[model samples]
Every structure is written in structure tokens, then in C-alpha cells.
Target: MGPTEWTAREEVGVGPWSGEWPADDRYDPDLLAGGDRRNVMDAYRYWRREAIVADVDRRRHPFHVAIENFQHDHNIGTVVRTANAFAAAAVHIVGRRRWNRRGAMVTDRYQHLEHHPDVASLAKFATERGLSIVAVDNTPGAQPVETAVLPRECVLLFGQEGPGLSEEAQASASFVVSIAQFGTTRSINAGVAAGIVMHTWIRHHADLSSAW
Candidate 1:
């Protein structure tokens, strides 16, 4: 089935009283009891919180996502949602411990998130796991992502909207990549840029034949 129709299958189990509360009930019971008004698709409606997270974890991709959060950027939520949709292994927040999740629409429950004090800490985590860290930026030294070879096991890192990337983040990455653009805008929205880089990684590394 195509993406549009993939979730059309009737959800087997959901609704009130179907299951126990998740060990980590990140959501309000009143919210869950009120028909799960969040933005998630129908298949996950009213399911116990942990069930959804477990399902997502089972199918998560090998690639991880890291974003510099020094500015408390509003786009972080959107980036988190997109990462969940793509089934990323985890999301590392560099330079900040908390970010607004309003744009995520509560999808953060299904995405594993890690906090790093700085870019160096994030780089250390990826390196320890043998994953190359690749930064997305438009600096003069950045390679065009469309033509570059992305690693099968790597972390795609991004930065804030106006500044693009921190000097430390760029230095920490094994290589920096840029998305092709012909428009007059100096940069795209950070969330959109993240989606582009993530989809590019999926195309080159994920097994589409097996993706649902």
C-alpha cells in the first residue's frame, strides 16, 4: 500500500480500558481519556502510551538525529515529529536540556530523545557507537548533500534557523553537508532543512522495500 493508504487498516485494539497505563505516562490521563485529541494518526488513537513507544522503537532506523538547541528554537518540535515519522534511532539535543514540544503534537512519546550539554558531548556519543556525525549547513566548506555519499550509520546534525550551525558543531562533525537551493532565501526553515536531510538519508540507507 502507498503512504496515503497504509494506515487505513482498522486498528485492532484501542479505546478506553483496553490496556494499562504506560510505565511512563507522559500524557495527561484526562487527555488520553478524552479520545486522544493529539495529532497522531488513527491507528494509535487511545492506545496505551507505552504500546505506541514500543511499536516505534521496534521499527526505528539506524540513523540518529542531533540538533543544537542553544536558542530554544521553536522548530524543535516539528523536527522531533519528523524524526518520529522517519523512525529515527534517537534524537540528541545539544546545548539545552529542554525544548518546546507543542509542534510535536505529543509525538515525542514515540521518539527516543537524549540531552547533551554541548556539541562535544553529542559527538562523543556518536563516535562511541561508531556512527559518523554529519552536520547540515550552507557554509563555504560544506558539500552538497544531493551529490554527497551519506554514511549508512551516522548522525545528521542541524542547527538554529538564522545562524545555521554553531562553530563548535561544524568542527565536531566528520563532514558538513548542504542542501541545494536556488532561491534567494539565505536559508530554509530549520525544520524543513531537517526533513530534507533525513529523507535523503532514508533514500540512501533505508530498505524501502520493507518500509510500511
Candidate 2:
């Protein structure tokens, strides 16, 4: 829906049931009885939060998204939210255990999230999991993501907005690809970059017929 056509979060969604409720276990009795105006899709309007998470987990994407949060970037929330939208296996936050979650719009509750102390730990985790570490940075020697072949199962690493990826983070990457920008801006926002990279991976690997 367009911006003007979109319903306000507080004003949209289902209201409390006035009659008999559905017998499905996935349906939350409280929600069904008392207005489920959550910011969820129509199919999940009255579904239990736990049930929704279980369903999402069952079909999550193979790839993961990670952000080096040494700077406490607000973009991390947007990245996490986008990860949830893309059905990423998980969103990894390195160097920060606590992040601002306002931009996630409660989607974080349905997505898997992990926190690592540093880039090294994150690298080790990816290595042990057999997932490649692919960094997104506009640094030299990096290939253009538009041409580079992304791994089917990889951790797409990102750094903060201004400084970009740390040297160690770049070193930890098995591959680093930059998004092509024609404008005078040296780089794009980490959140926007993450979305672009994830969608690129999806374009190459995801089955379109599976999606609506």
C-alpha cells in the first residue's frame, strides 16, 4: 500500500473476537479475544508470537547477516529489521550486546539474533558453522558485488555508517565486495547496503515460486 493508503499501526489489524474463536493451537487465545493489532501480516494476524517464530524458523534463509557494532550505529536496527524481512537465518551483532531495537518494529522477536564480543569470535563462529564470511565494504581490491558471485550460505558482514568495516573485520572476510555507487557519495548507509547485498544474494539463490 502507498503511504497515504497504509493504515496506522495502532489503528490497523484485527480487533477482539466477539464470537467463538478458532480452535488452532497456533492461535493465541488472548490475542483472539482481545484485539490482535500487532504489526504482523494478515495471515499472522491472530497467530501466537511463538507459533509465528516457529514457522519462520522452519523456512529461514540459509545466509546470515552480521553488523560490526563497535560504534553503536543506529543502522543496526534497520539491518536487523531487513534481515527479518529477508528471512535471514540470523542477524549477528558483533562488539555490542545491546542495540537500539526501535527500527525493528518488533520483527526482532520473530527473528534469530546473536551477539559476539568481537570480529574474531564472529569469524570463528562462521568458520565452525561452515559459512563463508563475506564483507560489504567499498575498500580497495574488493570486487563489485554486482559481478561477484556470493556464497549460497554466507555471513554478510557490515560495518558502521561513517568509518565502514574495521581492518580486522575486513581481514576476517573470505571475500569483500563493494556496492557500485555512481554519485559523489563515497558510500551508502550500512542499513541500505545490507538490504542491497541481501537482495542480491536472494536474487541468485532464492526460489521465486516459493514466494507470493
Candidate 3:
């Protein structure tokens, strides 16, 4: 099949339904019955929860995604969705144990998520795995992401919107990379920023010759 073409099993509903559901209502019966209405790509429409997850897992990428959850950032959900879309190896939630998944629109099921008590623990995890940690922030000393050399395997770390990366996060990152911007705004949306970084990794590391 083509990259955008998928053999859908059936049509599912896309609205409210009966009975208890997953914690994040990821498995919307209505959507599952009529087909998922969320922004997921064609390959995953109306598939069973486990089936979608298994498929994503089969082609998972080597890079990991980490976002600082100090404020329980709502954007984290959107980041998860993007990670799932790009088939990231895993997502690391730092600082908090729980985060809002509404933005993910139930796509988290197809993404692997991990939690760390603090930045130190997260740093340790990356170190043990031999994966370098790259923080997304625009500081005086930060390297331009557009020109930086990204590793084939590494963790792209993001901080909460507004506050940006914490001292510990900066300390842990091997280097900080900043996305280029010409607008008056100091920074872009955290979720959107994550998407740019992830795509950059794909362009550099992933084999896209068979993508179509």
C-alpha cells in the first residue's frame, strides 16, 4: 500500500458512547464504530487499541522524546500525538507523574510513554542507553537547530511553555538547540516546537526512500 493508503477494516462512530472507557477515553466507541475522527493518519482508522499499538511498535524509531512536565502542561498531549505520528521510540515525562492526554486525542495508545521523578533520573536513563540529550530552548549560548548536527539516536527534550527549560534540564542536556524564528514572539508553541525537532530527526536519520 502507499504511504497514505491503508486498508481500513470498517467504519466506526465518532462521538459519545456508552459504558466505561479508557482513562483518557482513547477508545471512543462511537469513533471506533464509525471510524476515528481525530487527526490520526489513515493507517490507524477503526483498528483495535492493541492492534494499532502493535503496528506502531513494530516500526518505532530510535529517538526518544522528553518534555518537562513541571506544570502538567496541556501541550504535552499534543506532543504525544506528534510523537505517535512520527513513531518515536518512547516519550519521557519528567517532574510529574501525570499529564493531560486530551490533546493527544487518544493517540497515546499507539505511543510508548515513560515517567521520571526528576531531570536527574531522566538524564541517567539516557546516559545508560548511550543516547545524548538535546534540549529545545533559545538561550544566548544555544546552537541553532537548523544548523546543528543531530545524533542518529538521541533524546529531544522540551520544557514547559513560557518558563522554558529548568536549570537541571539545561545541565543534563549535552547541548541546547534552538529553532529558528523571525517573528516578534520569543518562542513558538511547545507542542509545535517538538514537532519541528522530531521532523528534523526524521529527515536526518530515517530511511524515507520507501515512505511513499
Candidate 4:
């Protein structure tokens, strides 16, 4: 059977342009003629994909996000999606080249991503870019992220959901932090963990006055 028409069409957005087009080159002709219902914010509606990316790049935060993908963890896609939502400077994937993107909902298209074979290589990239490696996990001796003064410019690293950060990944970090938990769960999901940490960073560092 053929795919459902609604599945192929955007559910809600502006309908086709009725007349003259705008002068801005950033607007995609196709999107303008056929309503733009992309997952993007309304400010970016009808904008060319590259144009939206360029705008995001110009305003992205200094911090970068990195994740260890040793087991092809499905949560990696959620991390990418959150990174995009938070306007992270970039995302670095360490380990397996291929990852599950089902959770990202296509947001990866607007973000910059790099892949490295191992954590060591990711560390090298951090060094070259003057970014400290801040690892996140609930292991012993980890500082509570709520109180710790997170670096404004650094790479926030997360490991696989179950194992958390590996030894090598932990040793390479300039600082390691754990989120406070009252629940009985041993640990939180990687995707949820990433959001909490990112929000903490945002609270301490990001300029809220400019946010939409």
C-alpha cells in the first residue's frame, strides 16, 4: 500500500504563497509555495535550510557536546536533538561511525557534527580548540553539577546509558559531575541527563535575555 498522504505532508504550517515572493534569499521557494511545517521554529519558517543553519551558527554557544558511542546507544540521537535545541556549538561522536538517528527528528541537519575513532582523539580535538572536557556521570567523587561552576567554554561529554563514562573517558576529563537524584533509579537516561546538564550550564552561563 502507498504511504499515507498526511505522512508525506506537514501537518500544520502556512499554506502556499498567494502572490509575490519576498526579496530575502534566505527563504526557500519550494517551502514558500507549499507551506512550511518543518519542526523548526517559526522564525525559521520558509527559510532555506542552509540559511537557517548559518543563522544558528552565528549565535551558537561556545560549549560543545560530545558522546561516546561505543555500543551504538540509541540515546545518541536524543543528545543530538537536545544539542541543537540548546544551540550547542557542535557535537562530537566518539567511537562507532554510525549511530541511530531516529530520536533526533531530523534536527541533525541544522547542526554540525564530527566523528572520531576514540575518546583519545576526541580529547585531542578538545585540546586543539581550547575546550576542557567535562564528563558527566554519577560515579563516586563526582561533584554535584548544581553547585559546581561549569566552564562556559568546554565540551560536555556523556557516555553510554548503562555504563556511564568509561575509565579512559573519566580520566581525560578536567571535571566530572553528577546530577542529584532522589529516585530509586541507579541512573538517569543519557538523553535526560544531557538536558539537565545543559540547562544547568544555561542557567549559569547562557544569556537568557536573547532567547526566543
The best candidate by lDDT is 4
- For model 3, state the Cα shift of residue 107 in Å: 0.7
The positional error of residue 79 in candidate 4, measured at the CA in angstroms, is: 0.6
lDDT string for model 3 (106-199, tens) is: 8777788999999999999999999999999998899998989889789999999999999999999999999999989999999999999999
Query: For residues 1-212, could you state the per-residue lDDT of candidate 4 as single tens digits?
Result: 11112344537655665567788899898887777767888788789999999999898999999999999999989999999999999999999999999899999999999999999999999999899999999989999998999999999999998998989999999989999999899999999999999989899989899798
Candidate 4 wrongly placed segments (more than 4 Å): 1-10
In the range 37-107, model 2's lDDT, one tens digit per residue, is: 77887778779999999988888889999998887899988998899888999999999788899988888
Deviation (Å) of 44 in candidate 2:
0.9
TM-scores of the candidates are: 0.82, 0.93, 0.80, 0.94
User: Residue 89 lDDT in model 2?
Assistant: 98
TM-score of 2: 0.93
For every candidate, C-alpha RMSD to the true structure in Å: 6.3, 3.8, 7.1, 4.7
Query: How does model 4 fare in lDDT?
Result: 0.90
* N/CA/C clash count, model 4: 0
- Between prediction 3 and prediction 4, the one with superior TM-score is 4
Candidate 1: C-alpha RMSD after superposition: 6.3
Give the alpha carbon lDDT tens digit for every residue of 95-158 in model 1. 8788999998777887999999998889889879999999999999899999999998899999
True-vs-predicted CA distance for residue 16, candidate 3, Å: 18
